[model samples]
Target: MVIGAPASGQGKTTVATGLMAALSRAPYGLDVAAFKVGPDYIDPGYHALATGRPGRNLDPWMQGEERIVPLLLHGALHTTAQQPNPARIAIIEGVMGLFDGKAETEGFASTAHVVELTESPVILTVDISHASRTIAATVGGVAAFEEGVKVEGIILNKAGSPRHADEVKRALRRLGIPVLGVLPRDEAIHVPSRHLGLVPAAERDESRQALDALAQRIADNVDLARVVKIAMTAPRLSARPWDPAAEVHPPVAETTTRPRIAIAGGRAFTFRYAETTELMEAAGCEPVEFDPLRDPALPPDTAGIYLGGGFPEVHAEELSANASMIASIREAIDAGTPTVGECAGLLYLCREVDGHPMVGAVDATAAMGPTLVLGYRDADGTRGHEFHRTTTTPAEPTMAPNVHASYLHVHWAGAPELAQEFCDATHAYASSRPDLKHHGDTEVGEGLVDLAVNVRLPGPPAWMTEAIMATLPGLGAYPDATAARAAIAAFHGVTPEMVLPTSGGAEAFTLIARAIPGDRPVVVHPQFTEPEAALLAAGRTPHRHVLAPPFTLDVDALPPTDLLMIGNPTNPTSVLHDGEALRDLAGPGRIVVIDEAFMDAVPGEHESQIHAEMDHLLVVRSLTKTWGLAGLRAGYVVGDPRLIARLAAQQPPWSVSSPALAAMVACTTDRARVEAQLAVVRTTRDRDHLIESLTTLGWDVVTPAAGPFVLADSHDPGTRARLRVRGFAVRRGDTFPGLGPHWIRIAVREPSVTDALVEAARV
Candidate 1:
């Protein structure tokens, strides 16, 4: 949950820290974690004191907004050795005001921004010392000012008298916002502060007692039960929680040595995001911490240097006195070591900072100024940079052969490629694994019957081919998908914005894997292998729900996961699950993906989810199977427009060829739809005939096949090989997760082909 206020000096820190302590204490008995919204190192120290766990920062401006939920999940799930208990709840203290951000007009780095990203409910703390009935106007304005901000409760801090508290409560009741607690005015309970903000909890001897008093006061006056309930009511976040390992690209070479990246640490460089270190490790680099204020030199065999933002101006004299450290930094950069410096680090690399001599790596000077240069900047490398509330301004970045220094502090969450690029420039780098690449296309050989593939036997009809060929003469210009998208949208009965034309069903899976963020992606198995394969290729191992025997989908039996992938009229199994059953699997916080690549083959398309308006439902359709355009690779995904935009963002430029775009448009036309319906009737009859032929040959075939294929349970492991030797090629089911070598999948064919297959099986 987020704790925010109307503005600064409204006792946000006091309420936030108090809530953390109170939640972790006896009656509550809950494991609590703490986070500070912006870049304030001091408040985190107090947060650490309140809760045993180390406090972390969640700044959308410094770290891109994409990193907030994942970082929060990481901090809550993983605890320090000193505090082994995982956090059950998290308390985030807002910076400045609820809506005040990098600028007065924009809510880019504000508490409200973070709330929108995480969907965490807010408990706005109002300093009631100055006003009573006016509190409603203030709190009501804040509650309704933003579209997505959910202010669950209010805390009236520093109330002058009982009468004032009653008045404030009555006004809040009229506004329909609950007053959770009220703190009486007391100077004795106030924690002392210095220039930088609140003093570090470690520096004060009475810090522990002070925190205890605050916790007691909060427990005594506040409705702790209601607050906990509010926190629990926070909606399940839609974006998959960030995983450091998943975000990093796999090592280029397994045998390559991990590069050592020297990261600046200590109080001088505390502005680093937690994901930075995780990203380095993921990119096959080892991060070693070094203090510029104390460490005499860089770590023994460093290959790169990462200098983050901090209060370097405050320690300019100490940094300058450490001549050995400055010289070592200079030597590393001069020797072609890849170095990235931001803000304070930028200042430290300059010739002089506030009249004090620095490392002199960059050809410029940094000086303390009255004007603050801070905002959410969109840079080339990072998604956004947060130059927090500060007084120091450094010169522009000095780009060299192996050095990149800038005054902007970039968050590496959304841009893992930047880390990959940085590591590739270093001496210690390797290539990704190649063994994981495998697909059904590899099974198809020349001059084979081609039952090994699921695509229709014959290619596109003559008219379809002519339609595609007609676009080839106009290929001189770039392919514009505007008309094609509209055609697909018209066919699917969705808006053009909800349609995204992809290269193929395979490309759709790849895009989904890359864009959708879910830690636990559940793949219902014995289906097409591409979905799980795509997830694995994206550095995520999806949870497999392999069905046995009948191969039916059970919503109750399925484990809880944020993202789910299921095949309708399942691939190999040929069972058509009820659409409502699939819809039941989707809930408030889940994303359900239905792979309907072969759904057009179904007689009535009864169980297809294409037209379902469920927000979380994503239907992936392919024009390849019914239209026999495998070589052309045409498909489209249907879902919420917002989700469609995210998946589209991950695609490369002009991913679909001009011919493929034409095929997609032609296949969705009214004429093509009527032809497809006719073909579906023929395919269904052919499938039933093929199933009967196989059953007559004493083979156990999965009945009621909806797709244009059938799965037969064969005890012989060499069924595929035997069929191949008899001049027929069938798919081996062993590669599918739930199936073994004894099962084989065969494409539906006419009577003549079925007779040949039956005769071949007799061999």
Candidate 2:
């Protein structure tokens, strides 16, 4: 749930962290997961201290909307994994004001946008120390100004007296929004601030007491039950929970073997994304975490080292005192072990940090000074380093190959290749069991009818092609998603913040594999193999729920799992499950992904989950098939904005080319949508004719095929070969988890192609 305020300095952090602390106490006993919206790393520090779980940032602009819910779920579920109890609630503290975002006019990354995406009710905190009745008008304006944002409750901060609180509550009752609590003006409740927001909770002595007192004040004055109820009222999210493993994308060759990369951790290296280790693992490298502040040496057989951002400045003396640890790191770096350091990590590698001796991996000294170098940087010509935000003094370059130490804290998610490059430079090799990355495309060679692939032949219409070509001249500029996102949002009737355009539907699966964090991920089989393949690629083995003959989904018969994947009008079998039944599979802690790649092929798009707004539901749609733009590889994912953000965080910058973004925008337009609907009708008709002819020829065809393809039981191994000899190609179903060599998948075609297939069957 989102905790926002009318404006800055309205006590949002105080209310949010206090609420988290209060909810986590005895009576509630809710394992609370806290998040801070936007790029600031400081607020999450306070959130972690208050909730006893790591605080995460949800930046819509930096990370993307597809990742938010997945990140939220990852943090929430991860907290459960570490603790004795599971997290029962999630609290997201807003940045700036309720409606303020990346810009003053647009609410793209605002608290309200987050609220709309998660479908979480909002509790607006208003500083009511001066005003009484004006609080109602202020909240009412915020609630009514936005279409989807729901202001369920309010909290009046710094109320003058009991009478003042009553006056505000009475005024708010007129608007029908509940007043959850009131904070009287108290000097003891305020957290101290410094140069960069509040001094991190770790740096302060009175942090715990201050948080406890703040929580106590909230408990004494607020309606705790009402707050919990409001949070619980947030609908079950259907997007897959974010998994650190899914966020990592190691090159295929590296999957089998892994190199041990020792990453510095502990209180000094506290600022790190969990995805960093996951990314290393994805690149076929094992990330062994070591604490420079405590561990005497790096992990055994360490081939590389990584030092992330933290407070080396604060613990300079202790770190300097650990001469053995510093010496070991220095030796490893000097020995040409691939090493990368960021911010405090860079500081630790210097000759000295704040006049204290360090590892001396780099030639320069890093002394803490009054100057601060901070902001998002696109490091131009700084070999190997990509994009990041850093707050540290500059240092001289090191002599060793593959040794990079900088103040910039780069997020590997936005630049996965950088991680792979680092691993390749180190030549770190690790092995794993062999797995096939096979798909239908591998079966269709040159000089064939090309029935093996599902995409429509002849590709997208001319008008769509022209639209894509129009974007070619603009390729010099980075692909701007604003227009495409706006178009998709208009098509789906959601805010622009709700749509995330990906490279392809396959990329969507890969993103899901890398971002959505979950244990016991279940994939419904005989549908699409990509989901499982992507998961396996990310070092996750999904449990396959192989359906019988008709390939019907029995939601009740399924085992309990946190992340579930199902295809709409499933591939190969072509069975569309009931939409309500699909929705029923989702609950408080489950994410249900409906792969609607083939949904547009179904007439009227029946049972499509795209337009729904459930916190736990994610709908993945592909324009590649319907628009016949497979070669271009375009698609979009719809879900809670938070989930979109998490998935998007795993993607590299400009992952989707300019032309593809234009195609996405064009295909979602009114005229293009109409053309697509007509194409679906034609495809359905062609599919029916093909199914009938195959059945008449005594082939055991799968009935009621709703996709653009039909599955036939041709038990003989020679069937595909025989068809190929007759100048036709069909997909071998055996490669798919549940089906065997006997089953073949044939794409729909005109009567001319259907007649060719019939003649080939006779051969």
- Per-model C-alpha lDDT, please? 0.81, 0.78
What digit string (tens of lDDT, one per residue) describes model 2 on residues 92-147?
Answer: 99988888886444887788878877888899999998888888898889889988
The RMSD (Cα, Å) of candidate 1 is 26.3
| C-alpha RMSD of each candidate structure in angstroms | 26.3, 27.2
Q: Summarize candidate 1's per-residue lDDT along 623-693 as a digit string, tens digits.
A: 88887788888998988777889899998888988999989888887788899888888888888889888
Which stretches in model 1 have alpha-carbon errors above 4 Å?
27-29, 38-45, 52-54, 57-68, 79-85, 101-109, 161-163, 185-217, 255-257, 386-399, 426-763
TM-score of each prediction: 0.51, 0.50
Q: Candidate 1 at residue 588, lDDT? A: 71
| Per-candidate count of clashing residue pairs (backbone under 3 Å) | 7, 44
